[model samples]
Target: MASPWRPIRVWSPLLGLGFVVALIAFALQLSSRRHLAQRLWTFEELALYNGTDERLPILLGILGSVFDVTKGKTHYGPGGGYHHFAGRDASRAFVSGNFTGDGLTDSLNGLSTMEVKSVVDWRKFYMERYIFTGHLVGRYYDSQGKPTKYLKGVESKAKRGAQLLEKQKIEEDKIPSCNSKWSQQEGGKVWCDSGYPRLVKRPGDIALTGKISQRCACFKEEELGRPGLEVYKNCDYLSQSCSV
Candidate 1:
């Protein structure tokens, strides 16, 4: 019979290596679970994780939602290009491109419907790319971490913008777009292959923003008198093409 001690010595190195590997895996799992837990953080607590301290993870907030952006240290670190966004909820700054103290605010006041929707989309961006770690207990969230009236209003405005965008797309499919050309010799012209060209306030734009921007759209002969559409300045009522 062989000595039992020989087998133990032969397998000890492999057993130790396996143990170490399992230990590392366990640690990683614990870290991932910690990051996934939803913790309500005050503004001051959030500021501490802004990449200024190596011991803490880099975090950012948008619309009260906080994310672990430590993986993007190249961009969110103290001297990084996007460092200004690492500490607070600066939803407005994403759209305004103002990284200053005043511009880095969460206020959606006076933002157009579409602009609000764009800001909401940025939140979606962070949600997908980074780990969602918590919520900020301020403007958007109350002491209990639930959304406040102000946040609800902003969400409602963004939802309206989404609905309008869908409606505009459907209308475009129905009306299509006019083909056009312009030059020094002919000034400008618009026409359609199977319909008439008319200028109209872009659907959902003026209605929501009080803006007067217009676009050339093609419509059937019977639909020519649809509200908000007008013939080109010098074009005849039934002309297939018109000089602009």
Candidate 2:
């Protein structure tokens, strides 16, 4: 990566004049469109489609944060003059507009940054939700194997805080085991991660089934796609599955 300013000194005065002209034009355009009401579609239009009065507020709240606004209406930025309509925001700080190809919309999001498939980085998608929001993209599952429809990853809002997954970096460690007859009879068993027992990704020695732990905490009903700790069924499902 390199700056393109290597030969810009000769054009410095010209560039300065152009910049001034551009800034003034931008300012005037903004001032004129600040209060123009437009027909921007809210998140409700995207989410419920028809069913309203339920999650409409929540969805709109997110939409307003991701778009732009001028005066008091949704401003979709310059190209289209402005957005369709104002979305929603607590302090009216953000508004929904439009995005074509990439990047975030406004700026309100909460997702554990991770690579989803063999390709595609989820960082931009994660940011786009909270900043410049859009329709639900990801799906979160509880350890019980249930879909968390209300959210994809998790939001920082206190009421929705439980769904949030803490990004715990795993460290290697040896696990202890029991040598009981039943253990031996059942082909024995291996304890899961000795250090990160609650965050099991695969079948292992120890299964922390029904075990209450800070590390294994999942606020969302589902655990996204992390295997072993599904929330459905009775206790010890994980433990039994990992029986050695």
Backbone clashes per model, in order?
A: 0, 44
Which ranges of candidate 2 are over 4 A from the true structure?
1-24, 32-149, 152-172, 175-201, 204-244
Best by lDDT: 1
TM-score of 2: 0.20
> What TM-score goes with each of the models?
0.72, 0.20
Candidate 2: clashing residue pairs, number: 44
Among all windows of ten consecutive residues in candidate 1, which has the lowest summed lDDT? Answer: 2-11
lDDT of 2 by residue, 1-244 (tens): 8986675436588899999999987887666434333233444443332212222221232322232222222223223332222233221122212333222232333221211110111223324542333332223223343435433322223223222222122221232222223344565333333221233342211121222332232222233345554332333434422332
